[model samples]
Target: ALHLEMTGFLVVKPEGYVEEAAAGEEGTVYAEADYKTQVATNVQTQEVIDSVVVYITGRNYQDFPEVVALVEDATDQLTFAEDAKAKAEAAAGTGDWQNATLWAGQWWQYQVKAADIGLRAKTFLDEHGAVETAQ
Candidate 1:
């Protein structure tokens, strides 16, 4: 006979938006939510653990091309943020307070893009992914 037991779980919810401007026009066009899960197992004990994460994102676009560009830019920004965070951590460890603080500020500034990131992601998922607003 075999038995399975539940152990532990966690969840994360994130929300954000993207805005675009072109020719003095600006708008928000898309929004989205993402869900993720993680699991762990103990073979002998037959115990399982699971975790979930959810993120919400949105964006505004002046045109379809702008939306596409925004998506690409947002992806690049995310990569930059990751690198900046790592550099900041390294600076802190090295006792370079000034550089550490600057990097840390950069890391935090990158966090502001969460909304823009979400918006671009959502726009990419949509079939007619662009929305325009009168300015």
Candidate 2:
């Protein structure tokens, strides 16, 4: 079965960045980090298939409130089902398997969200679900 795991908002700093931020070290710079908000997996096989994530760059180490707001804003922007569908379809149409898989995973997320609200949703994987094959 398709398993959707809601990871929610997670802010991951670079290696040692957390300690540096805690120590209030000077000359600290900011870079972007991808936060996984949600993930999809095959329950029977325990294989990760897709995920919803967001990236944000920041400068201030103590500005968690602002960062929280930014995360919320970015997460809100990803809830468009139509946009996800369009992107997924467009990618698939162009035979961009990589992007197609990414967007399709995103589209599946919207579908799962829809299902949670009592709306009908479709599955993204085939009848066998997601299977890992050696490349």
Q: How do the residues 1-135 of candidate 2 rate in per-residue lDDT, one tens digit apiece?
A: 113223545555567774533564555222111111121221211122122220122122123454345345434544665586577568657766556556656666655553332211112212223233332
Q: What is the lDDT of candidate 1?
A: 0.44
Q: Rate the local accuracy (lDDT) of all candidates.
A: 0.44, 0.39
Worst 10 contiguous positions by lDDT, candidate 1: 32-41
C-alpha RMSD between model 1 and the true structure: 25.2
Q: For residues 9-108, what per-residue lDDT tens digits would candidate 1 score against the true structure?
A: 4323346645456575544221111000000111111121011001112224434565556556655665676777678668667766555556655654
Best by TM-score: 1
Model 1 CA deviation exceeding 4 Å by range: 1-66, 120-135
